[model samples]
Target: MDANGHVQPYIINKNMGKPMADFAPELPKKNADGVPIVEPTDEQKYMFDADGWLLIPNVLSEGEVEEMREWVKRLHFDPESLPDHERTILAGPTQRLIDHPVVMGMLNEFTANPALSSQECYGFSLGTCGYWYRTAPNRRTEGLKEARAFKPHNGNGLYRLPGDVHFYNSFPGKSFCPHMRVVWELNPVKYKQGGTLLVSGSHKAVYTAPDEIQDPDSDVWTTYECEPGSLLFFAEATTHSAHPWTNEENDRIAVPTLYNQVDGGFAEALKPDEKLLESMPPLRRTLFRDRYVANNVVGADFKRLWRV
Candidate 1:
């Protein structure tokens, strides 16, 4: 208490840079040459970058869908009939999705540790393989256009602390999101009937969500209508939730899986069963590789996913 003998409050925070500015995110539709050249994922990149989500219609085949349905139903309803290892979302056929090329190709930008991927060490990790089945509740009353709309959660806001992987940052021709979800519906999601609910562009929100965006009752939220086997990719930063299965005709059967950067962990994700791990082939096994690439704890760079 020398000199002035006064007190001042102390505050500490990140000084990453100057204050951030919000801007329009829509990419250019056309170029100087009229219609510009587009790659297979260019459209997807645009949609996902702008809205944080996109649906690839009908990725699984009819037979594949049916097979999955059989397994899912048997596992859910008649678990005793199948072995314990087959009781998981990663059971047999679904295991192929652990390293699906479509997911790897599309989400590589979002979840891959680029340097690690370049080293061919399988840069992405599978967070969870989920088979979600939901049915409407009993005792339905008057006409309901939208009831039981899913609650919104997990959006990336500017005030988040450092070391947060469930975040989104984008630049021209590039976007970064370390955590993403891929939802594959084995049953149809009809319009306003029920599906995954999302706020179109909330992944890049710079401020807290407004009342309208937060309320499922508000029409500001949106959902999709797709055939069975339709797939969707969305960043973890995007606020999303699942609508109830209003269509009692067929119960909703969706396999929504989360993927992430191999070296990071978000949401306290669980590891797949040991039996499931042992049964996988080399490539699929990579999705669940132990996370220790920086210091070469598990397998160093230039190594297989399953290291002894």
Candidate 2:
């Protein structure tokens, strides 16, 4: 009831089992292109095509970076009410954060971006935490000290490790899906503080043993050192790994998001909401095909723009 004697609108009315749109206006179509539109510069394209990774500096603002760091600290030190999954020292945000609009928007932007073309597959990696006490000592070990000599390995399934080593290849026989990964640094990177080590052109070559391959002479293989706000985008095929974090004083925190290129017609399987699809124009609907031209079509027909 209104205070002035007039009847008040049913502000708290509940309409269970009713279409939400019947009561409210529609939401903006964030996936108009079904891919990200931000075009990668020439250098970015070259790096991505050849090496399968790109280092983007200052992708997030200082404030946003601080907020993530605070969240990491809170999760790390306090476990009274946190879930068992989030108790690890290298925990990412709760499932709530993963579903948050900010994270979802970022994922959509990266996946649907027009520049990437629809050829890429997108998926999320389970948030992980790396703790020193639970693993091996990184500094004193000979295998951990030499970063360049570190062999590549993939964390496709799950494995526990004792020390720092460069990961160059994923598990053999495990159809390692081709994808990109977003690494959000929750902690700052000082020299030798395990950040991430990457080999530039390694993604183009087949998986090789450490002893069999020589170190790249070019500036391809290098350690990534950045502030907390930095976001790293790399190819799944790229050779990379967690750099050893010798700083026993501070813990290394990061949220890694993985995406990959898929075969064409993958989106057809999603079964999206009809109302959502209705709002988009036909041009925007076709954007997905434009982005991800199938490799088979590229190799076989070569004349056709798309496969399916």
Q: What does each candidate score in C-alpha RMSD?
A: 13.0, 17.5
- Per-residue alpha-carbon lDDT of candidate 1 for residues 1-308, written as tens digits (9 for 90 to 100): 11233221121112344322211111112221233212236578788888988989888899989988877777667788878767787876766654556666665555665434532235667777778766655533333223445667878642457687667866554576777888888898887667888888888877777778666667768888899988899887888886766776666777888887666767444567788777665445656766645642223433322223
The list of candidate 2 runs beyond 4 A from truth reads 1-39, 83-151, 154-177, 206-221, 260-308
Looking at model 2, which ten-residue stretch has the lowest summed lDDT?
A: 19-28
Per residue, candidate 2 scores C-alpha lDDT tens digits across 1-308 of 32334332221112443322211111112333343323344465445445556666665677766766666556545656666645533234222223233333333333322222223222222222232221125533332223323455542211223231212223321112234466666566665456666766665454453552334333445666777656566655466655545555445666665433323221122222344334444433232232244342211232222122
TM-score for all models, in order of appearance:
0.76, 0.47
The Cα local distance difference test for each model comes to 0.65, 0.41
lDDT accuracy of residue 168 in candidate 1: 81
Best-performing candidate as measured by lDDT: 1
Residue runs of model 1 more than 4 Å from their true location after superposition: 1-40, 118-120, 139-149, 157-159, 268-270, 295-308
